[model samples]
Target: MDNFAHLFQGFAIAFTPVNLLTALVGAFMGIVVGAMPGIGSLAGCSLLLPLTFHMDPTAGIIMLAGVYYGNMYGGAFSAILLNIPGDAPAVMTAIDGYAMTKRRKAGKALFAANLASFIGGTIGILILTGLAPTLAALGLKFGPAEMVSLLLLAFTSIGWMMGDDPKYGLISTFLGAMLALIGMDPVNGQIRFTGGNINLYSGLTFIPIVIGMFGFSQVIEMVTNRMSFHFLGGEKLSIKGSLLNREEVKGILPNALRSGVLGCFVGILPGAGATIASFISYMTGKRVSKKGEQFGEGVVEGIACSEAANNAAAAGAFAPLLSLGLPGSGTAAVLLGGLMMWGLQPGPRLFTEQADFCWSLIASMYIGNIICILIAIAVIPFLTKILKVPAGIMAPIIMTLCVVGSYAANNNIFDVYVMIAAGFIGYFLNKNKYPIAPLLLAFVLTGTLEKNFSQAFKINGGSPSIFFTKPISLGLLIFMVLFITVPMVMKKVKASKNTGDQPG
Candidate 1:
């Protein structure tokens, strides 16, 4: 009852004319950013952070949250209409979505993506509302050992759940850990791997690394391919025509809901984000679908699973920001910086000290997501026409935007170089069926995992059993073991059954 009262109050605040208008504007801008290749919610939020300085903290947060989810809705437009994904999470969407477009069911695919996003986003918001406080309370009980165990669980989940090869996932994770060790040591105050370079003293900046990995890498790939342009194809979409038939709608709902739930769970974990969510969702949707072999061949279930998970992950990414003063994903990290800039600390203290701001932020998620749905529905037809643009014209524009976006991320040319390098790496990896999600997850989790692990060891006098001593830590370890073990067992069983079915 008290929660309901607080939510009602939050809605009252969020619905104010000024806040509503800010959310609308944020959503509109988010769509534009998401439609553009190489731009993402993190960049969109970062660009808008300075603007928030002039507004009330609550209103500012509302607008920021709107942009976060709105970008997700907008990301689907390009993923479906064109082969390019505007954001990492949308990559899975492009696989089947673009295939569907080529089959002349672009409108149907767009509708499914939109509807799935709406459902996933709404569910995630509701889960956030109901579960955040509980998670915050739990976070208060975390000691160094518990935190370390949790980090281990995150890494294990990411490694086990993503990628075609677990070995490559482990390699990516170790590489990220190495990168995190480049700066001054947290315990000894000694420079570890800076090579006496002044810029290395601060270690690699997150903004530069992310821009290089996602933004620059793409440009290099485009140049190497000598691609003139990428394009989409579809007539102007009609909402009525876009609506899925009974069979199509029914076929995708289960996968969408499942992916939404899975994405939300993953998103709440620090260091796991929409990329992992989408990857896992796509794989799982394929495993469960009756037409699993048709996954990359324009299956509606594929689109639903990927889009639903990514959007839900976007919503779930806020959990750590609100509850623990920890950012779950890159965009959430940027939002954390924005909060600090506003003189508003996140975590449990913020919940009590800035109750209205916190509640209003949550409420605005629901409102903003609904608004994004309406906006996407209204704008998708116009946006879909970009597919018809000749590839010759589109290629150069994409390359230019990719370079500009990478440079803009940190205003550093070094980042552009890094992006190009990462892109070459990504392109080759993609060709070889090496999954990128595990690499990304490894990069994101290494720092926190190492810090917490070292801290926990120091507290426990180097006793590995410390993790098993705490109930929460023990529970998490057990969960991780089960999660990893079960999949292997299932795979073995399936293989055995298949072998048995074959003639001797």
Candidate 2:
């Protein structure tokens, strides 16, 4: 009852005209930034981080939260329309989303993505509201050893789940780990692979690398392949036609709900971000759905699971941020910096000392979530028009956006060069049919894995027994082992049975 009363007070604060306007503007800008390939929530929020400095801390945070939510909703746009992920989390969405686009179901795909995003965001927020303190406490139990085990499990599962030939996935995984190791060592602060160039000291920036790989590489393919510029059967695009039938809505609800719950849990875990959540949920949907075998061949369930998990993870991330002062993802890290800038110290003290501020931020999320969906739905008709642009015109436009987004990350000319090089590398890799997901997964998790492994070793005085002794770490290791071996064993058993059935 007290919580409800406080929430009502929060609603009162959030209903203010200034706060409402800020949320609207933030959501709009986030959608725009996220829709543009290569400019993800991290870059979008970083660019806008300065704007919040001049406003009230509560209102400012509300706006940034709006952006965070809106970005999750918008990231699917490019993935569905252009077959290029606007951000890392949208990578899984592109597989089926682009398939849907090719089938002239872009409007339906967009609607489903938005609907699932809303459901997931709502679930995450509700969980955060009721269990922020408890979830934070649970997360605090994940020490260095546990984190290392969990990340290893993530890497192994990602590699195993990606491609038909597991070898390709493993190769991509190793390559990503190698690329991640090029920068400075987290434990020793010593550089490893930075040759002679000073720019190499900081290693590579993610934004430039991603823009080059996904965005620029795509531009290369467009020009080289001379692909058709316009989408087929886009003659009568309208809002009414985009509405999901009752059956489609029913199909999305269960997947979205399941993914929402799963995403919240993943989001609470340290270093497991929305990208991983989306991947895991999409894979889970594949295993459970009756049409699992048709996942990448244009399935609404795939979009529902991926988009829901990512958005839910985005909202669930706030639990750790507010209660434990920990950032759940890269974008959350930026938000952490903002929290400090606002003269607020997160943790138990925050809820006690700044209850109004915290509650107001929570209240604003509900409004922002609604505003984002409504805004996104309204813009669908406009966004779908991107499919009608000519190839020649779209090609140059995407290239320019790629360059601008990469340069904007750090205002560095060197990043542009890196982007171009990565583009060529990505193009070559794609030509060879290499699975990119494992490489990306390894690249993101390797650094975190290294840091935790170092920390665990330091804590245990170089004894490897620490990992085995910790209950959580041991459990995760067991799970990882089972996850790897069980499938292979089952495949062998099935193969033997088929061989025995052959006529003599």
Best by TM-score: 2
Estimated TM-score for each candidate: 0.79, 0.93
lDDT of 2 by residue, 129-202 (tens): 88888987888899999999988887887777766677877888898898888868888989988887788777
* Per-residue alpha-carbon lDDT of candidate 1 for residues 327-426, written as tens digits (9 for 90 to 100): 8788999989889888988987777788888888888888899899899888766766665776555556655765675676566776666566666676
lDDT of 1: 0.75
Scored by CA lDDT, what does every candidate get? Answer: 0.75, 0.85
Clashes of 2: 0
Instruction: List the RMSD of every prediction in angstroms.
Output: 4.4, 2.2
